[model samples]
Structures are given as C-alpha cells and as structure tokens.
Target: MSLTKEAIQLITDTALVATAKALDTDMPTVVIPEGAKVVNLEAYGAFRSRFRGTFSTNSLLDFGKYVTDRAVGDARGFINQDEMTCSVLFNLGTEEAPGHADDRAVLKLKATAGYQAVQAISGRAMSQKDMSDWIEDWNSTLSAVGEDNQNISLVKAIAAVRTITVKASSESDHTVSETRASRSAMDAIEATSKETLPTSLIFSVVPFEGLQLREIILRISVITSGAQPALKLRWVGEEVQREEIAQEFKSVLQDQIGDAAALSLGAFDPK
Candidate 1:
C-alpha cells in the first residue's frame, strides 16, 4: 500500500527528533580559523629616453643639436615628463575560539571508549544465529512502534546488507585505546544502520529559531552531504502550514532516538 500522509508525517517527525537527540548529546562547538591574509598589488610603468652631447666640429652631426631639437619640439608641444608609483598593502586577521582544546580532548575520550566496547563485543564468540537474532529483535522493535513506514523499511533493507566482521583474535584484554576504538567503531556502524527518513526531516526538528533554521539546515546539509535529508516546516499568517508541521515531527524523532539509544545500551527489555 502507498504511504499515507499521516505515515509520511510520522516518519519525518521521528527522524527529526532522532537527529535533534544526536545533536543534544554531542553539542559540537563551532570552530573558526586562526588567521586570514589579504594581499593587494599595484604597479605603474613609463618609458623615457636620454641623450648626451659634446660640442662637435660638424654642427650637422652634433648630438647636442639632436637632443636640443627634440627637447625644444616637445616643449613647444607642451609635453611634460612625469613619474608614477603604486603601493600595495597586506593585512591579516586572527580568529580565536575559547576552550577548543578541552572540547577536543573530551570528544576524543568518548570516541576511544566507544571503540573499546565494540572491540570487546566483536571478540566474543558470536554465532550467525546470534546476529540473525539481533537483527530480528531490532526489526520487531521497530514494527511494534508503528514504524512500518517507508523510512523504517528502507533502514531495515540497508541494515540487512551490513556485515559485521569479527576478528578471530581475542579482544578480552584490550588496551584502553583499543577498547575505546572498538566502541567508537560500533557506534558508527549502529548509526549507519539507521538511515530511514530523508535529512530534511531531521532538520525540521532541530531547536532553532525560525530565522536561524534555514542557515543551520544549510550547514547540516553541507556537513552530512545529504546523507540524512530533512524537510522544511513553513508557517503562513495565523494558520499552521502542513508543509511546515514540525512540532509533531520533533516529538516523534525524540521518541525514536530514545528508543534507539536504549536498545543500543541494552537497557531495553526484549521480553
């Protein structure tokens, strides 16, 4: 059956909420470059010829005659010799952000920890049966939440194609860095597995003021490269526009992300 408008709306809402949750959890700080330089070039060129003459016995062959004649001719024509100079300047400006180093460190630590967890899980003896079960459980959860929408279907299809490669070597005794790396890798895979709705839907739910929404959405599109598309929620006069219906969208997204987070953490009871 074709997707109903309500189904579309619900999918968009859930996707946006999930995106917002991701943003809230990882409030990425803005970064500006250290310095910028500008250079300007200006130049002028002119040509001039000079001649020296000594008194000659032959007046006809005199250099002074040639020189004086040309000078007198130019003077009669009111031509004046002049020089021109051009100047250029170079300027630089710096952009400094506060607490950037500390923020980077915290992010690095979180990523490392996540990687380690993934490594540990992968090293464990997990059978094909376990993987199949995991997939089934994930699908069932989505189905139970009325997420049979097109977006969810697409996500499931994509996830089915994903292969979780495990190393034969034991990962039980991993270094702190290795453990963090493992967890980080798994987190990335999990995020990749959930690509249902378009990115526009994600932006619709972001907590941005109306004027700022467009700019932020543009930024997100650039960063994500349209991996997750979102929709625009517009308003006209006193009436709420359907095309701009984002309140419900945000709510649904939040719920979906919460559910996904719980599942990833193994906090959700499958029973």
Candidate 2:
C-alpha cells in the first residue's frame, strides 16, 4: 500500500533519530565536571593529535634549491647553473588549484655529483688575499673540476671497458659502453663512492605558513633499478619532527585557549 505524506515524514524522522542514537552510542563519552556548564557537546572532544600539512608546488621546488644553495656555502648562481642546478622532482596534478592551493607537492631532492662539484668550485670564488698562502696552496691542489653528473670513479671504470658485444641477427650494430666486467668494476667503485658526496642536507622546511621546521635533515640514497639510476631523499627522525609539530600546535592552542587547563597530545577511543 502507498503511504501518505504524513506517514512518509514520520518514517524519515524515525530513521534520522535512530542514526543519531547509534552515532552517540559509538562515540567516546567525555566526562564533564559536576555543575559545569556544557556547551557544544558534539565538539567537546574534537581535539586532534595528528595533523596533515602540505606544500605548494613552487614552494617545494624553491625549498629544495634553498637547501642546496645553503649547503654549498651560498654559492652564487649555484641553484640555476646549467650543470649544478638543483634536481628537485615534483608534480602538480592536471586539476591545479589557484594560488598556493595545490597541496600534493612532495619535493624530492636528487643528490647528484654536481652538488659536490659546486662545493669544490665555490672556494675559487673567494680572492687569494682572503686565504693564507698554505690554505691557498692546498685549495689549488683540490681545484680540479669534477664531472657535473657522473662520478669520477664510475666514469674511469666505464672508460676502461674493453669487451664488445657482436649481434648475429641485428639490423643495426650497437656499441656497448660498459660490459659485464666493467659493470662489476663500476659496482665496486660505487660501493665505496656511494656516500662520498654529502648524502643528507640539514635545513629548514616550511610545510605550512608560520611553521618552519629548522634543522630538519633529509637523507638521499641512490636506487639502481632499470638502465637509469635515481636518487631519493627520505625524511628521517620522524618522531622528533612530529613532536615539534605537536608542540607548535599546543603552543597555539594555549595562546588562544588560555593555560588554565593542561593540554596533552593523545587520541580518544570510540566505544
């Protein structure tokens, strides 16, 4: 039988009430002091211990360059120098939000040999008068220009390769730069030179406005998967960083909410 308008309204109201009751039963019950005036009961225990922060696409790239620029003793034009440009990888989805609204940007600082090269060359920018004669002599010996991208040992190993591959059923002949023996040699060189250059950089990162994480170190490691190798910078000491974030949040809360009550970092359990 078709229900009347009043009957349908009654059924809808009953369902809404039942859902509210279920939610209340499942939610944790926050105890209130006796004779306390309760206000906004739904929002009483809404304090969140963990928070998410994101950086804008351009901000991420700039931050990456800033870190490198600082590391190489603030070398002039180091960030944009053709061979020494900071390799910051990131992407903004097709649907980009205007201004700094794009939050999915995660900057990956690809630690390349050029960073070391820049460090090696930055000394040349200073005048000889600014250095002691002995220091200058030592600096001259270390002034040899380093390869922009390739490691010196790896380049030497590949240059020493003598083996060649002869294809029997190939349309065009191709020359193999590094044979298996050379690869083995390169691997040995890489094992020692993997961390020859600075692997991690200590700097500040402002993931959110007015919130700068100072002395946050990001460590990079090389990954050899396919024909081309890649570098990845991963954040370490996450617990410490999180603690700093929590403290910042706690301070802000105390400033506005007053220090009458003690604030702690934790979560609530739903019954």
Candidate 3:
C-alpha cells in the first residue's frame, strides 16, 4: 500500500490494548519504557478505532526505533536489539466486481524461513509438514543453518522478520472474510494469560487501495480470513521466490515466534 491520497484516507488505528478488548484476544506484556517518547503514539489506535489515517511503513519503523533508542539512552538494559523491532497489521484484499470480460492476474507471496533453507539444502521446497518439522528442529537444536542452499541461511533471514505474508485479491468468494472481525493482535502483545487457551483472536476489515509500505515489518503475523487460520513471518526487503524464495514472506508463522509471542498466543489454528 502507498501513501497516496486514497491510501491516506484508509488509515485507521486501534491501539493494541483496545484491539485486544474488542477482539477478545489474549494480551502479552510488551516491554517498553513507561514514558518513552513516541512519534506516532496518537495514531497507534487508528487501525481499530475507525479513525482512518495514512502513514508510511518507514514512519512506523522510525517510531519503534525511537522507543528502542530511548530505552538505551535511559540505561534500561533489560532487552536486546531484536526486541526493538516493530510489527504492523493491515489488509490488502478486496472484493472488486470481476465484471471484466477477461481474466486477471493474481499474486500471493509468502516466505517461511524453513522452506527457503530447505530449498537451499535440497533442490526443491518442502511440504508444509516438513517445513514445520524443520522449524521445530531449529527451535530445539538451533542448528538448521549451514553450507546448504549455496549457504542461504534461515537464521540470518529470520533475524530480520519472524514472518511475512503478502496477499493481493481483487475479489474473493469466501463468506467468512466478509463477516469475521479483525484479530486484535495487541491482546497477545499485552497478555499475561494463565489459561492455556487463546485470550484473543485476529479480525478483518475492508481492504482499500492506494496504500503504501516502507517494509519495516518484524516478528509475528496474523492472516484474518477464518477459513485458512494461518500465520507466518516475513524477511525485510527479500523478494519471495517460488522456487527459492529470498526469505521475504514466510507461512505458518507458528514456528518463528516463542510461545509468549503475540501470534503464538492465538494458538494458530492450522489450515
């Protein structure tokens, strides 16, 4: 999405805290300084509160960096640099009438770190289960990367983002998409749930055009279509390759984040 006039009109914010409440999601504690100066503090709730406004991806990343840098300046040494990353949630699918006389093109790009490394390890992309297994292996052993796939490293790629999912749809027939509420990702971000089940879930919204992306995504994701019930991580600036994805957008985000991570708390219902 671009930051054009129409895209600007599509901006919305519902802070993660409120987003959790509206969606009945589990909230996870996100570590941040109590009074860290933030650039977009006011706009944080635009996504869920029906207060549409447009801002670029870079702007959001900068705001996150501001907090991280401020924490360092304040001598708050409780976190790592990776914890400084930011995650943004938005939609790009639409139900434009396909009244055109001709067929149109569609592109869905997702990258899972395990898949890329597997392709590099072998000669082809692995199946979903295999990919999941690969991640499990890494999570437990942390030894999936090596001199395979021409030395393409899943560890390095995932370091940039935990998951990435890119979807473009002019039209879709799934009725669930039309009725499902947007998942309140923040609930997981702020949750301290003692229960084993999910405290929150993902939601949906009307997808519009003219949006912009500066590509600063990091850590965890949710795809709101209820039928699929999927999750994944994305690598910054990496173009997804059908044969050998560049580690850009990955699928089945369950493996990328820890149990306490936001997307993981959703209990990611598998497809």
Candidate 4:
C-alpha cells in the first residue's frame, strides 16, 4: 500500500512534535536557523508473503526524518551541526508478527547528533592521586584473596565497593564518534579495574548529527560487595536507541559513498 502526501505530512508533523517532546524543547516558531534542516520525511510499507488464496499478509509502516543544527558558542563543538538529526520510526505490525502478535506498535523517537561545545561542570572531583589510591586499594583487595581462587576471589573484590560512587562531568561538544570512542575507553578502564574492585563509570555525549546531546551512564554493580560485577548501561535522551543508531549509521555511510551504488543503498535504507 502507498501512503498519500497528506498522510505522510501528518505523520511527519506528529513525528516532529514527538521529537520536540523528546528533546524537551519547543518546536521552532519562526526562523529555521542557519544549520537547521529537515533531512527526510518518508514512509515505508511492508506486505505479507503468501502465494496461496486470500491469506492475510501483514503491513508494517514507519515515518522518519532527521534534523541537523549547529551549536552556538565559543567552545568547540565535538560534533558539528552536520552530525545531528532527529528520527521517528513506528512498527505497524500486529499479532501475526510472531512473538509480538499482541503488540500493535512500537514508536521510536531519537536524536543522533554531535556536540562541538563541551560544557564545563563540577561533580565528584577525583584527582590523579585519588585514582591511583583507588587502584592500589583494589589491587590489595585482590591479593588478599588467594591468586588460585579466581571466581569467588574476583567476586569478593567487586562486593567490596558496591556503593563506592565516583563523580563525572558531562562531556562538552561531543560527536557521535567521539562519544562512542569515549564509551569504548571507559569500557576498557572498567574491564581492567574490575580485576581488583567493583567499578562504576558514567559518560555523556552530544552527537553532531542530531539536535540533542545524549547522556549515557554505565554501572557495574558487584553482587555481595565482592563478586565480579554485573554491568548495566543506560542512555538518557529524547530519541536514542539501537534501531535509531542503526538508521543514522546507514545515513552517514550513504553520505560518505555519494555514488550510484550508495544512492541505491540509501534508497533501500530510506530516512
């Protein structure tokens, strides 16, 4: 089934309104701004696959668009306005779609962009010496447990600081690439630190591809204050998720290619 322009516009307007709500900001009233632009407004329709007589197939539909805007300020934006975008996709699948038969729709609103300006703030301040001391403490804790006893010993270290809290400042002018890299770095640090004590780390980022910057927090809770920890990662934003990430990644790839094949690929990916 094909969607009409009016239908598409209505969907776009609703998605845009939803985007504003997710960003916790009001919709633009007058000027569109220098860097601001609506990237795409389109819809998709899915059909069921049944060759036999009147077998009821499924129809899955979605509407999405991205907005890019430049950040204003003196600080360098890690992600340029070129990197930010807004998107909304809804799954119109019904009960026939396997496990989610009863689940009618899955609506998603995401802001994927870059932040060039890094904000400066104060939180739990930890000096280099403090980090060193924590590391030493962790090592000592590990040594207390027999080296041969890996499993339970590791657990013990994790449990030692289940409530040990560390403060971190939000990132300034962060791009998606920079944010991902930062997260990867933190993950590495957590992995190494967990060898001795329970560790918790948090980081925030603003992608240049979208309007809002997303804050991500990761927690590693040591069960029983000594076991190896269980990890939990949370992302706080207007519209940020796995599917949205995938869509944005695909868009970036298409822009980089800018060829016939790339256009074809973009066609398949849509907005």
Q: Which one wins on TM-score?
A: 2
What lDDT does the true structure give each of the candidates? 0.25, 0.34, 0.27, 0.31
Q: What lDDT tens digits, residue by residue, belong to model 4 across residues 1-271?
A: 9999878777766666555432222322321222334322222214322111211111111211111111111111011112322121122122464221221111122332212211111122333334334434434222322234233343454444333433333434434673464332231112233235433323345433322344433333322222333333223342444346455545653443223121222111122
Q: Per-residue CA lDDT of candidate 1, range 220-271, in tens?
A: 1111123332212221121232123234333332332232211111111112
Off by over 4 Å in 3: 1-115, 118-134, 140-218, 239-271
* Ordering by lDDT: 2, 4, 3, 1
TM-scores, all models, native as reference: 0.12, 0.27, 0.16, 0.20
Candidate 3 lDDT: 0.27
Lowest summed lDDT window (length 10), candidate 4: 68-77
- Tens-place lDDT digits, model 2, residues 1-271: 9999878777766665555422233334432333222234445566632222343333333544443433322111112222111222122112352122122212223332332333343323222122223223333222211234333232232222111122222233344565533222212213123223333433333434334434444444444443434334445675676567546644543342232223333421111
How much is 13 displaced in model 4, in angstroms?
77
lDDT of 4 at 252: 55
- Across 1-271, the per-residue lDDT of candidate 3 in tens digits comes to 4487544433323233334323222222232223321233234543442222322232323433333333321111111112222232222112362121111111122223433343243323333244345444554323222223133234443332233233433433333465594432221212111222121111111111111212222222344444332334343233322212211112222122223122211111112
RMSD over all Cα atoms, model 3? 31.0
Which regions of candidate 2 deviate over 4 angstroms?
Answer: 1-197, 259-271
TM-score of 1: 0.12
Evaluated at residue 110, the lDDT of candidate 2 is 38
Greater-lDDT candidate between 1 and 2: 2
**TM-score order of candidates, top first:** 2, 4, 3, 1
What value does the lDDT take at residue 253 in candidate 2?
35
